[model samples]
Target: MRWFIFIAIYILVDIYAFQAIRTLTKNPWIYSIYVFLSLAVLAALIYQVSTLGAGKVLDIKSMYVFGIFLTVFVPKLLIVVFMFGEDIARFFVGIFMKVAGSDEAQFMASRRKFVSTIALGIAAIPFASLLYGMIQGKYNYKVLKYSLEFDDLPEEFDGFTLTQLSDVHSGSFDNREKVEYAVNLINEQQSDVILFTGDLVNNLAEEMDDWKQLFSSLKAPNGVFSILGNHDYGDYVKWDSAAAQAENLRKLKNIQNEMGWNLLLNENRFIEKNGQKIAVVGVENWGLNGFKQAGDINKACEGISNSDFKILLSHDPSHWQAQVKDSPRNFQLTLSGHTHGMQFGIEIPGIIKWSPIKYRYKNWAGIYEEFGRYINVNRGFGFLGYPGRIGIWPEITVIKLKRKKPQT
Candidate 1:
């Protein structure tokens, strides 16, 4: 039923867009070529979908297939929308002419060539942008640094640098050398501790099999601590059985352990410096509305005191908004990355940072402060669904902790 609806929508939009193209170019040869190309693209899309079936895992081939579909269909959809608007206006104009008893034929205008040209011109923008995103934007890794000051920060831990990488989604990576380079970049930061807020794989645990050694190289004096993201639970894919899904999660935990990462599951670990201690609490993936809610902040902070400076690692920023911000225990800082900024957005430091994901998530990207608490939602370290990123490139966040000096 879903596929039927999708096909119906696609065919309607394609027909509309082809009509607009026909208006722009009346040459028979040009129209023939356009029709042939459209058919070829449609055939390829059908073949890809049929081969993948309903349980698509989104491997490299699947990524390319989806990318091709987006590149071809998105622009056509836009063109169809514009053409539909023009048709509606024309219909209303004809109705008004008939009601006013005027010569409708005199005022009636056919679909203008200029309108078609304009539609094509506007559609080209996203087509070009998406192509660029698939080719170069996904691998364009950027390091974002922040210095956060807090009155409650322990003096001994002042200037403590922490590096965070989130949403690795190892299943989506097609290049090894590029990933290795990213690993080297993380190591160069020389952070006191490395934190990974999750989405290590798209679904299955095997996605990280080849990348384990590469990620194992990530090191810090205080060690790497990680928490599971929504994808790690195998919730998005179909499983053979409940046991099989449970086993997949168990293996993922084992893989994290093998990589020397402390996979904190609704628990807390302390990082001590010069006898001053700060708690690093981690919770399983917890999100709002339809997403899994396995994270328990209260349980994770069980033994810790409010006086002890604390940082919480939760995958979704919504968790911070839903529970952490107004919790009885004040969590000074939280790190998250489930948004991925929709893997597309315009982010110009200090000027503007915007993504459509904001409409769905309040704290979609970067540092958000509420009630004196801070949550840094890392834009993610890898690409997923669309196979690439646009203005919102992959991110590696480095946070420097500072102790605020008392005013005299």
Candidate 2:
């Protein structure tokens, strides 16, 4: 039924957009080519989606197939919108002319070539943008830096810095060179410690087999700490036995250990400097939207005190809003990455920052602060459903902890 609706919508949009093409060009060859290509794209999309297994990971080939569909469909959808608007106006004009006793021929006007031309011209923008995004925008990595000042921050860790990475859907990655470049970029920050709020694989442990060595090279003096995201449990995959699913998760945990990452599972570790210490608490995946709730904040905090400057690593930002914000235990800062900024949006720094995902998640991207506590939702280190990123590029976040001095 869902597939039926999808095909119906695409065909309807394509037919409407074709009206504009016909108005602009009477050439039979152009019409034949356009219809042929549109049908071919539709067929490919259906085949690609059908082949996707229970895991629904969208590997490299699937990614490109979906990418092609978007490149063609988006522009045509826009053209349909414009053409539909013109039809509505024409309908009203015809009704007015008939009421005024005008001739039938004069009552209804021909479809305007100018309107079709304008619609086609405007539609080209998204067509070209989607193509560019698939080609170059996916690997466009950006380093986001933040210096957060906390009155209770330990003085010994005043300039302490940590880099946070999250949502590495390794199975979706196709370019190893690009992955290597991003790995090197993370190390270049040279943070005191590297914190990974996870989604290490799409649905399998072996997804990371090819890229393990590259990621293992990531170095920080204080060490690299990580926690699981919802995807780590192999929840989306079908297994022959329950044990098989559990073993997949076990392998992922072991892989992280092999790469020298401290896989914190509902536990806390202290980063001591001189005599002062701060807590790094990690929990399993916890989300509000029926997602995995394996995370236990209270258990993770364990013997840590409220006075300790604490950094919490949880995968979904929704966790912060739901539990962390009002908790009696003070989590000074929280880091997460699951939204991926919807992998598409219009962001112009101070001017504008918006994505469709924002309607679902208030703190979808960048940093959010409330009641003197901060959470930076990393835009993600990889892509998922959408093969390419439009505006929200992959992120590597560097956060510097500073102690606020008391005013005299």
Candidate 3:
């Protein structure tokens, strides 16, 4: 709903901006016609994308319109992309330069154009890379990864290995070869346990049948444990009857079992080896917003003692943010996915990694530790929209947990 409004306004603003640029240029009439027609072409194409089933024709039309924008619209866009950055930089630098030292003020004043260019380029670069990645399969991979390291741990269980995969969205995958490769990657890890945090299929459990045999190939020394992601509930699919949704969820549960995973739903189990015990707990999706269902964390932790080392698998990182981070149960680690880093991001020194998702989960990816608790959010193993990833690669994380040795 918000997206629809944004696109509508974006097209409108694009038309107005292009027309205003045309008024400033040579052959104004010609440019105006081109701008108006390009926008119309774009609008019609976007409408079809919303209503039509995805296929070759729609794809071809989309590329055609995009190519038109990239080529023809570049001029109009640059007309401002070139101008807007300078204006903003100058406005900001001028105000700051007075209070700032002479050299400092001049330096800021000098970099306005650079800053502006960089600001515009930041957005333009990722979006353009996303489009180009579609052609090269540069952003397409069936893996998600994050590493876990524990400090001040038990010597025996410290460096315990766990691998996490999440949001596979098997429905979004088309490359069987890639699926096999992902499975092989998981199997290759010298892991004691493998955890899949959820979204094994998009919305249809049937989507997993073709890939189930492939996924069944993954093995760890201990076992694979999984919990439901939001998509696994089958809410995104249209149902002829409520029974169909129920049936799909049933199939999803069975699919998890068939894949040889311990499906932990608001439950707990203990992994004991060599005189050490670690509790593994999982809960159904209890996101922060409308998606938040009633997943009882206390119930999941019921039988487990607080002194035992514990790991948790919850779907949304936000759930950890809301509940798990400060819970009294003493879970040492929590694994989650569902952010996918927008399946797009910017990378350099400190990446500006954000999707609309950041507004939801501040610790959307990598490692987040606060107040003696930790969470690792996987970027995701599958593509969602535009069928690709850019900057953020799919991950296959191997985390090592080590116990602190006794002081001499």
Candidate 4:
């Protein structure tokens, strides 16, 4: 039923977009090529969707299928928008002509060739962008830096720097060289500590089998701390038995340990410098709307005090608003990643930062502060669902903690 609605929408968009193409060209060859390509994508989509089963995870092939579908569909949807607008204008124009008793007036006016041409020209931008995103933009890593001021931050840890990465959906990666480059980029920051807010794989633990050694090289002075994201739980894939699923999660934890990451499961650790300490509290995956709620913040905060400067690692940003921000516990900074900014959006610093995900999750990406507490939603270190990233490229966040000066 889901695929039915999706394909139905795709066909409608194609038909409307084809009308625009027809207006611009009388050439049979162009029309034949266009129809052929459209049918090819539709057939591929059908084949992929039909073969998917309950236990099947979203693999690389499915990712490309989705990516190709988006590459073709989004531009055509744009064309439909322009053509629909033109049709509406023609509708009203025809009414005005008939009202005036014009001799040659029809129920609707013909589409202008220039308008169709313009629509296609405009649609080409996203078409090209989607292609680029699949080929290169998926691996285009960006290092985002921020210096946060905290009045209660301990003086000894004033210049503390931490690099945060999240949502490493290893199952979707096809290019090893690109992944290596991103790893190198993370190391280049040389932050004091590395914090990974999870989703190490799409589903299976073996997904990281090939890339384990490469990622194990990531180093930081204060050590690498990590907490599970929803995907890491292997809930998306079906297992033969409960034992198998438990074993899969066990293996994933072992893998993270092999990579020198401290797998904090509703646990807390302190990063101390000189004589001052700040709590690094981690919880399991906890998200809103039926997502896994394995995270226990109160349990993780055990033995910690409200006066201590605390950094909370919970994979989903929704946890911040739901519990951390308003809790009696003063969690100064929360790091998370799950929305992935929908893996597509327009973001120009200080100008516009927009993604469809924002409507679903308010703190979907980047930094947000409430009542002096902060959360930095890493734009994700990897891609999932869609094989590529559009405007919202993969992110590596570098956050520096500075103690705010007291004023006279």
Candidate 5:
């Protein structure tokens, strides 16, 4: 029933768009060519969806789905907007003709080629952007650096540097060379600790099988620590049985351990330098509303004092806004990455930083501070869904801890 509704709407839009194309190019051969190409694109999209079915995971095949949809949908949307506007103008004109007792004047009006040409021109922008996003934007990883000052930070860790990454989404990766390059870039930062805030795989643990070695290559003197994201629990896909799903999660944990990552599940570990220690706590997926809420900050912070300088690794920024900020124990800093800036947005340093997801999640990207505490949301390390990124390129964040100077 849903498919029927979708096809019905899609056909209507296609027909309306084709009519505008016909007006722009009156040649029968050109019209026939456009019709054939449109049908072929639609067929390819339908065939891909049907073939992938319920077991669809992010891969090269998924890219085809996004590509075909953008190719057909963007142009149709532009054409429809122009057609609707022209119809409104024609409606007012018709009313004038009727009032003037010149109803026959309607026969003289025809679809304007300039309007159709303008629609086509406007539609090309997104078409080109999407194409570039798929080809180059996804691999465009940017290393962003931040220097944060804390009044209560441990003096031993004053110059401490930490590298943070999130939303690897290993299942979506198709280019090993590109990923290898990203890993190399990470090593170049040479931070004291490397923290991966989650979405290691899209749905299954097996997704990491191919890239395990590459990711295991990531090194930091203080060690690499990780936490599970909402997608890590195999919750999004149907499992054969409850036991199977549990086993998949166990394997994912084991894989992280094998790669030398301390998979912190509502747990805390201490990082020490020159005998001075700071707490690093991690929690499972804890998103608001529709997402899973498995994180327990109190449980993770057990045995740690409120005055201790602490850093948190949580997958979703909402967790910080909801629970971490007001906790009895003040976490000095929190690192997160679930939002991914919707993998599309414009961020120009201090000038402007905006993404559609900002309306939903206040701390969508970069560093956000409130009530003396801070959260740095990494703009994901990989792409998902759209198989590309537009303006919000993949990010690698490096944060340096600085001690605040006291006023004399």
Candidate 6:
């Protein structure tokens, strides 16, 4: 909806600017008139945006949804495939006429219809997928079973289970009812600890209230912990004042608190159970730049012993580059959720296929072990711009650490 409004505004501005420039070559009055008209349109758009929001104008957000779908979606394909599905049937009709005989000329006459129908159907799949994604688009939740093993064992911490879920961008969730279902799904895991890797919301920090009720229902046997994701800082949206943005962050943090989560910002906490000790470290939204950089491993790991079984929660899988591999730290496991697989792709039997998001991210999902360090990226519990999960589902990571035999 916002995209449509933005496009409409851009079209208006383009018209006015083009007319204004053309008129400048003739007379001052003509140029002034066009310029004034452009400003008037912009003013009107601003006023309307203030009153009803972009959502008011989008009665049927499907037709011109290309502006929102193009990033990872294609709609023209939908129109040709679904709308003009007759061609597909006629193509088969011609094939039957040519092969089985009877009415070759008649078949030829209607073959294009079949072809058109098929093309439209083929196109309709992704578009409908996008449309359905807009409507019933949901988060994929999978319990990625992996372990980080070290030579030493924390006596009481062995066999501890941590339920990990990440990238629950509440802002992109348009279905309030579905979100409640998701909450129920997460609660069903019932792990000893719940850790959220990041990306709690898509754009605005104020979106916290939207899912407050749903989040309030989440409870674990031990406790819930969270770290800031890139989106949590509210960088994508424009605010009238920086203070407003700051206050928004504060509100987001408060929401986390209300949800019974401990926001571990570049800090560590000890989990002592059965006389065994383990450290849980959390960092801010730090990544490889052009993203957030609030994660401070140094601060998070400060005063930690070398041998502690440290579980670090960093939003980005890229953060493993900075803290896990070569850093002089003992972070046994790091949890991240910057990538939700863009809610596309496949996870089939022996054939993990689909989606181009893999081209951008090496360890986008599942457990990735590099240089003896480990990181797990969650598929996420919410949708983004296109708003659907075709195959690469959202996840609920059930991580159970294990012991590894020493290399003799």
Best by TM-score: 2
Residue 253 lDDT, candidate 5, scale 0-100: 97
Instruction: Name the regions of candidate 6 deviating beyond 4 angstroms.
Output: 1-118, 139-150, 405-408
The C-alpha lDDT values of all candidates are 0.91, 0.91, 0.72, 0.92, 0.88, 0.69
Q: Return the lDDT, model 2, position 189.
A: 95
Q: Clash number for every model?
A: 0, 0, 16, 0, 0, 31
Q: What is the lDDT of residue 289 in candidate 5?
A: 71
Candidate 3, residue 340: the lDDT equals 85
Per-residue CA lDDT of candidate 2, range 229-286, in tens? 9989988886788999999999999999999999999999999989999999999999
Locate the minimum summed-lDDT window of 10 residues in model 2. Answer: 103-112
Ten-residue stretch with the least lDDT total in model 4: 103-112
Q: What local lDDT score does residue 45 receive in model 1, on the 0 to 100 scale? A: 75
Worst 10 residues of 6 by lDDT: 55-64
Kindly list the per-residue Cα lDDT of model 1 for residues 36-94, writing each as its tens digit: 87778777778887887776566777778788788889999899989889889879988
Q: Write the per-residue lDDT of candidate 3 for residues 1-408, one digit (tens) a residue.
A: 965885675666466445334434468677768567766856765765666443212233444455444433444355455455565766776678666744555565446445444544554654466466554443255343444555545556766888888888887766677668777878888689999998887778888888888888788888899999888887765577899789989988998898898999999888887776788899988887678575779888888887777889998988887888887777789999988877666645364655665776698878889877888888888756556666766777678786545568
Instruction: Return whichever of 2 and 5 wins on lDDT.
Output: 2
Give the range of the ten consecutive residues with the poorest summed lDDT in model 5: 103-112
The digit string of per-residue lDDT tens for model 4 on 1-408 reads 887897788888999999988886789999999889898999997888779777778899988998898899999999999999988888787788779987533334234566788999999999999999899888999999999999999999988999999999999999999899999999999999999999999999999999999989999999999999999989988788999999999999999999999989999999887888999999999999899999998899999999999999999999999998988899999999999999899999999999999999989999999998999999998999888888999999999999999999
> For candidate 4, what is the TM-score?
0.95
Which pairs, if any, clash in model 4? none
Residue pairs with backbone overlap in model 1: none
Q: Give the per-residue lDDT digits (tens) of candidate 6, residues 1-408.
A: 975787674555344324323422457787677457545644554554465453222212321243243422243433333333454665676788778767677555455445444544465566566555554446434545666665565746666788887888776655676667667877776778888888887756667676787787888877889998887887866667899789888988888898889989889888887677788899998887478788778888887987888888988887787657666676778888887776777678466655677777777877877667777887787656555567776677887766666688
